[model samples]
Target: MSQPEELLDESLRAITERTVELANPGSGRAVAALRRLTARRRTPALPVVVVGEVSRGKSTLVNALVGQRVLPADRTVTTSTWTLIKHGPSLAGQATVQCGDGTIETVPVNTVAALGTYLAVDGQQQLEDLHGAGARCVSMVLEVPSPLLESGLQLIDTPGVGGLRATHRQATLTALAEADAVVFVIRPGEPISASERLFLAEASEQIGTCVVVQTHRDQTLKAKAALDADLASLTDRQQWCALLGDQERADRVVAYFRDVKGISVSSRNALLAQDEPPGPVRDTLLRSSGLQMLTEVLQHDVVAARRRVRQRTELQLVELVLRQTRDRTRETVALLSGDAEAARILEDRRATIGRWVAHGGDLWRRRYRAGCARIPDELQVIVDRRCAELNTDVGRQLAAMKPTEIEKAMKGVLGLPAQVFTELLTEVDTKIAAAAAGVRELLERDGLAQQAHQTDDDGVTFERLGDGTFTRASTNLSVEDLKHATLGGMAGVGIASSGALVLAHAGILPGALAAAAAAGTAGGAAGTGLAATAATIAAPIFWPFVVGAVAFVAIHQVSRVRARTREQARTVLATVREEIAGTALTRALDAAKEVGRMVEEDIEAGIRELHDEADRARRDLADATTLTPAARLARISDAEDLLARVEDLRAEAAALAGRI
Candidate 1:
């Protein structure tokens, strides 16, 4: 069977070539989009990146999947670089390291022990031999003969987060995270911790789908108890996902992650089964390890996820081109037939989109700007109200707690800010939803965008957040660390230090807390795609929150505020609130305004695309109307045939996406 990408490529080339033959100037943008889409580099194999917090049995899980101890699975040895495993003809003993200077070096490995030693990421000294080729190692590839891998599964073992150095956390994770499916390995206890939640949130936003594996099933003799525990934790994740603006991601999280009970696997037990003789006992251990179910689920998700990514990324261009060509062809048919009334239908349709663009753009722009202007102040109100509540909530704990415990109480009591930011998120999501629906009403009503094309790819616009690069918004930090940690850290684009992540790929969960705690600096939002069409934007919210959290802790611990009385703590917090509100929150407000402007720009750009389509139809119809009656009839014949071809291509694009 042809992959969706192959089919899309074939269809796109046909449609684009035919469109070029017609010499349609209006199809230029759509044609160019396809050219750029097809010209980009393609992945040879589907990358299934295995990621998790440190010591969560990620390496062990990879070992069990491949039925070998090729990687160092000892928790003590931190696997720093990525171990990119692909299918090989034989169980070859060799290691290839891609250096930072764009050079690749291969070394012969004598034994499994030698592979482990050469690839170990424990200490700088341990990797000296491996690092001798270059100043930095990009990734290490190990080829192993496995039936599962032979099926085009490229398993990558990355260093776990949480325990990684601050210098390397978010940047490395973001780069390594561009995978078809993320095998998120977790230990038995924490279905997820705080840092792990942040990482998973980022993963869900970036990749859209992942297969979560609960490792170390052998450690617990769980009959139904373990399943229940895992289910409860995942239930919370479902609720959180429901809150995001990308309803598709939320729906997928439910569909993909709904049955995780069977996905629990024990790598140790699976490895032990491999050591056992081929007998009933060994088979029982293998079944008990749950490795079969894990692999099955992983494979199912792998096949399904690649298609989704393809649809969202490149295949979208094919669909868009088909829509543009189809719409234009329809108008051409009517224009050539010389049926003034039939052609009027398209003219009126173009006029509708035109009216929406002219009238709706200003209306939505005003509303969008108003909402954007209101949000910062609303966020400030959320801050002030939540802080007042925090002052009250922490006071009760303060009466019973000692001065030393005040720091702990302050940090814990500030849960109010999280709630406040969550409210802000809800408001932002509402406005974004409203913005998307505002223009879509006309598109859906008239069937101009064909209603089918209204999905995220062609006609849809404005997910709640966009992934834009951010500038520093906070001022109270060292230049080196705070630079990357601002809005993306707050909730803009980049992966922040692993505190809290809220990504539509624009994160506010971490940054909102930073704004609340340290009186946030400016945060940013952008569309990384064409008008940020492909993905949502929200900067990270990690580092600023970390800085703010620490700053809040410091502010709360002043000697006068450390007094036994609850009132003194309240007084100090009151002072801190004023300071944060006047300085940081105002900056946060400015950042939010910037986000609002970007949201308007993206939404308005999408609206303009529709208008441009109508405008092209108008021009084509005008040109055709001027032709002689004999010439017009001849043009009608060509136009009808062109329409038929576009319809076939459109159906193919639809069929490919329907399964995806």
Candidate 2:
């Protein structure tokens, strides 16, 4: 290899090695991701892609590389899909061509004419088959014996640009993704168009290394001069015109192969004629030296191919590993800090709560007797007034509602007064909740003060502190609180109901008559003896006490179950969180680390192998120096200039690395 190529190989080795180091597991995944991206960018194949406005000899160039004129070169657009061609060989001396998807097929030298049909390029309908197959199937491989070509180098032929129209632009763009380098072909007479410009803008950066091939060598000078004249006419952009070259009617076709490099080649037909018998055309074609020039271009790029592939692949892996690790870490942090778990835990606590309600008839009867004796007359006066007001309001409402109107209104109305009842219950619930809250606050304060007296199994002495000093351990209420409170509330309601019932009965009956009847009943009961009479009157209280006892028992049972459930919930939650933290999260993190390690190792190994291969290539290039005189001259003319360019590339690469 030349000194420039060696330097390039060295720089590539350094980059790959650095990438591997950065990709180490348990370290910076972001750095690894960057390495993978760099590796992808430095892929070995300097892809030579064929791009043009429709019908611009892209497929023809693909065929020429294989030394077989098999590509569809019809008047109509014969090539519809993006077709990739790679190097391959057959048992016969003739070239072998394999379609995409690794299906090998061979064509004899004589059978080259049949390729249009072989590729299904008869018409739009035939081309549709290839288009529908997608890029993978549409691609094919062709091998030719040319020392200038490198291993694993591919030349992609794209769909005719204008023929595909806007409808198929996406497919064209997708095909562009596979190209490592590009060859843009433009026909004579067409202006640099809007669509073409757009394609150039989008693809120029992606296909970083590009060459423009203006086909039909006979018209080369005319095309060049015309393009130059057009560009020069724009006084605003004269530099571009001068850079493109303004010479008219030259013998060679020109190509701006790089950012600041340009080359010219003679007609391909004349060069092919040289291998045939000597003729008048042979001398002229030989002087043009088109074959020799093209060969050098291909060879020069071939040397850099392997390095590019390694660089690109490593970069991709680095990026993937880094992104995955970062995402996993973020997810773990969220799981640990988020409120969702707390909400779930609270819901489980709610499931442990139990409810009970009861009112004893015995307690109600005692309260009923006392209330009746104390307030019978006062209750009678209030009831009479309330009844009078209700009757007047009902009469007025009835008068307002005519018989016909009443029937109509009654269709939608009910005696329940759903709206009013709902509001009334809501108000009652609010007041009860407020009262309960106040009671709880008072109880909590009292309980804190009484904590010194409360004793557990340890029997440790303690002193009550202020409310603020009480911790959650002591502030929690037990099932006993709910049971006692529920029972007390039921007893109060029973007493109030009993008082109302007694007062209502007094208003309905004459007080004097009732008293006389009660006295007579007592006399009768005395004749039967006080024991029998007492038993008869005690039945109501006896049944009330029995009901109260049953209610109390049920409440106790429910409270115990709720308390047990709460305890179980607390235990289960603790175990679940522990298992998740210890096992699931731990395993996930371990797996992530393992994946990172694998990627790091892969990148390291790849870098080492690439470095070794580059060294071997250097030795091989030195040992097998069999270039022709023309090849030697071509190399001398381009090598130093190319080295200078490659040096700049190294510097650029360094700058990019520094930024990273």
Candidate 3:
């Protein structure tokens, strides 16, 4: 490669490496496509596409350019598919067929006419046949030993469709999109059609260089004059004239074309005299055909134009990578910081849960204590009534009762007050439900109701009581009776329901009553001893006095036992009430704390994930920035020396173009 070509390759290689790295880091589909494009630069092929309407001698022009009878050139629509002709040691051809299953078949090209069987064109098979047969021709490749092909120029002979059919127009436009330069062929006798003009306009936009070829100049002289007049008129238009610029430049262009008759050529005459000896006839035909001048134009001006296209394409690819990298970096940074509105919403939720834990605790404590205060008095009344009934039963049956019957009667009286305690506990559960409702109301007012009830299959919801997370229905305390009330289970009851009360156990009343009864019986024995001592002190004179003292002692013992039992029952009931109230308040407070903790953790995790993504994006941006065209140029050793060498090479190429 020449020095300029080597430098260009170095720059493109640097870009391709950087693009591959970005794609490796999971940059999406656009980056992958860009990588493919950059890789293609390593063996860059400049395509010089030949395009025109059907029967315009485009195939003949391609064959003439290649100096071979390789391409099929006939009056009929012989060139059906896109034919790519490039340099090789010997003449060879191949066809690539795309099958319906996405498989491809690479077959040797035996004859040019076989292409019509796979491709669709005028006078060939229907276009739909290719689809129906589950196969279609993609492209035909021709490798020939031609000097022009060996100069790194690939000639493309595109099918002529006149831009009328949508598929044909698309195929033509696609070829144009990939062309570095274009050769538009027109017959001398015919005027440019609207479709041809449109094709030229679009081709001009995609390709930097375009040369028009007017074929069949050996026809009638009058037709040739009319064609020249048409060319002059077309050249006057700003669209065509702007390509030549000011009057001075226009004059130079007109002078150059005057010698060649406005790029008018006779392919027929040129082909016939290819092997003829040098004589007046050969010289005159060659000169009038304008093929020699067109060859010089392609060798110099077209080659420089192709180089310019390569440079521009490389520059565009670099810009695209930089733009995508910058955009991704910005997006990641925004994610790390988070959305202002969503962050505010999370903060508000945190603050609300915090406030509920603080103030709601005090409110719940007050409600709980007030509701429980009435329980002690209600239980005392039940105890007193049950004791009176027991005393009456003992008075009526004492003389005839057995020891077992008296024991049974005493146990029955102790158990009667259990129902009263159950009622008091039931009332306490109602109060607990009300307190939970208060918590729900507070959360709803602050827009945290949804957050509180959002539960996953693991039952990890915003509202946690103790061990279990509760929904609105399950949190209700009143829905079922408490089977085994414990401090922990009571704490687990969520306060999300208003109408129900959840109790751990209804057995709290019976258990406490049994213990209180046992203590009352022990105290009664002590009271009986004290009463007997007092009775003995007052009576001490006779047997009759002793019997009366015994009866008095019995009555006093019963009264003392009943009084102590009543006092003990009241104390036990009071302690149970206080315990229930305290537990309810503590669980509510804990539930609020748990909710606050969960919210904070979720927010922190989101921020952490965003920060990780941002860090990766920032690193990628740094790497991409380092590989930019300017930065890559700076990194090259002895860049200034190499650049000077490249400039000299470019000057030489420009001089060659000027001479042509």
Candidate 4:
């Protein structure tokens, strides 16, 4: 194993065994989860989830990947549930359906076409009605015989009807959770809609590997070229351009996939070419269709990405447990030092917190809100200006590139918002930290903590955070319920530098695809990685950010750009700019809402923590006053031992985080 993996593997073992000694309930849960992950690590294959907007050819792409017509894919049919296809001794299918009252029904699917009957979301009401009132198939598992399946790779075909939107919201999240690699299918000229962007943003966090395929590449380009001669289709020489795809936003919504591996493959053509006798026509069709290259990506790029993802997941689990353990230790240390002198300090400190909240809480909240209110506009100007700059740079770069290189060229052009968003979050975190420092300086000026012991960092820490992190920032115990709650499952490890990821209990994080990209280029210390992770989880609005952000239509159609008049190219660039600005503006506004909520939550959290701490201190003080000398010494010694062990684990965690 490589060094990082070796380090992680060794840490996992240490945490699993040593954590059991901590005698903390939270550590017990972490140990359980770590052990579960350990068992799964022995089985290395990560399921690939194939996804797309309605009728974007997700099913077809899955079939292409399997190199067989195992799944039904007709224009009239739409997949409406999760279907897991794995290697089986024979071709067969089974489904799990649920009634409105939440009763589950099992159904046997005997044939390939029958699988379609259970899978279709439209044009098959009669077949669906057979299931009974309020009954809907929630999921299915199909056993398909294929060379691809033999390799232990699994593919999940997602439903198309509510695919990209919110109707099957939880179902979509389930897919995100299970996927180690994603195959995002789109047709020629389809700009990722806002909803698609939202889902991808979340999915990007769970897994860094994605393959974006533009289906109908050959046909769309040909038909589009004919349209340039005044709107024509296969059947009519004067058909409207709308026959090809949605063009109302064509001028404004340029097809852009950012930071993803995209290939334009004609899935239909690949299927047809398979049946043809060995010849140049067949060879050209398969090669030019981009099917061969896509298979390579699935076999190579995406498969390799899964390994890296596993490492990150292991890191997140270990880090969360370590932090929780640290907090427990810190609390223990404070309790041990609680005595006649400490009791007086705690009472006064708690009283001070009470007074501040009563007098200054509302004003602090307002100030934070005011700070957050200006973020949208600031982000808008930056995103707009960035896109505008990219338009010129992209046009210049594209002018000399071949069609095949367009995807490569555009990948570098813009994954807008990801970078801008990262920079913004870093700024926000820095400000929050600085504000905490400023509060400390003010306390020193007034000598409010004049009696606070210099040797006790806890007093300083709690006082500084009394109105900030010290109060509001506590372990969410989120990792115990991690899998379903949010992207925190994917994030907690890398960004614990500020303790924010562990503190915020963020159920949402910005897209990691872009963050990971930024981390690579901005490589410095673990602190930098923490800033990047905070940037992601802190801003969920950008969860609806960018895809591989390349114009795939231009990528596959080599001669099309050359044929376009300069006027047309300029128009395309103009639309690209508008698309970037409009999308960013809408998402920025959404982000502003999250920013406000988080800001308010942070302040409220502080207030809540203050009251809780005060109550705990009052109880601990009473206990301290009542303790016998011998008993007090025993508890103190025990607490000290726990605190030392915790500190050692924390140092180990810190070292590991630095490598991230």
User: In each prediction, how many residue pairs overlap at the backbone (N, C-alpha, C within less than 3 A)?
Assistant: 36, 24, 10, 12
Model 1 poorest 10 in a row by lDDT: 469-478
Off by over 4 Å in 1: 1-43, 48-291, 296-327, 357-360, 396-400, 404-407, 414-426, 435-584, 643-660
lDDT of 4 by residue, 464-534 (tens): 23232222112323211121111111122212222222111111122332232223221112335543443
How good is model 3 by TM-score? 0.39
Error of 1 at 156 (Å): 9.9
TM-scores for all candidates: the values are 0.47, 0.36, 0.39, 0.46
**How high is the CA lDDT of each candidate model?**
0.50, 0.36, 0.44, 0.50
Model 4 alpha-carbon drift over 4 Å, by segment: 1-36, 42-46, 51-57, 72-80, 99-103, 127-129, 159-169, 175-268, 275-277, 301-316, 320-471, 474-660
The candidate maximizing TM-score is: 1
- Please give the lDDT score at residue 436 for candidate 3: 38
Candidate 2 regions with alpha-carbon error over 4 angstroms: 1-46, 91-114, 118-120, 123-137, 145-152, 162-164, 167-169, 220-223, 227-276, 286-291, 301-660
When 1 and 3 are scored with lDDT, the better candidate is 1
For residue 619, what is the lDDT in candidate 4?
A: 79
**What is the C-alpha lDDT profile of model 1 across 539-614, one tens digit per residue?**
2212122112222233334533334445755665555555454434544454445444444554554455556655
- Model 2: per-residue Cα lDDT over 1-660, one tens digit each: 778656765665565454444222322223322332353354444445677776666666555555555455643434333444545453112222222333323334323343443333333222224332211112234444433344656665656442223212323443454445556665556665544544554354244455555555544567556545434332223332232221210101122222412233333563365465787777666545344555556556434544543343333333333322332232222223322432242222222111000132232223323322333233334334433543454323544655555444333222112222222222322333333333334333433212222222322112233442321111111211221122111111111112111211212113332232223220122233222322332222111111111121222222232222334333333333333333323332332233223222322232233233334333333432455656644554453443344344445455533332
Using TM-score as the measure, name the better of candidate 2 and candidate 4: 4
Per-residue CA lDDT of model 3 for 1-660, tens digit only, reads 678766665655555465444422223323433433343345647777888887778878887777776676673324235677888887767765444343445566654455444333321233224433334445567788888877788887877633322223334544554456678788866777654654554354334466778787777566457667756755555534443222433443343333322477778777766766889888877787778888888877666556655554444434344433433333333223333432333344344444544553453345434544454454445445544554465534654666566545444443333233333333433443343344434433544332223333422222322224332111111111110011111211111010000000111112222222222221111222222321221111111111111121222223233322333434433333333233322332333233223222322232233234334444533543456656544433333333334344334333433322
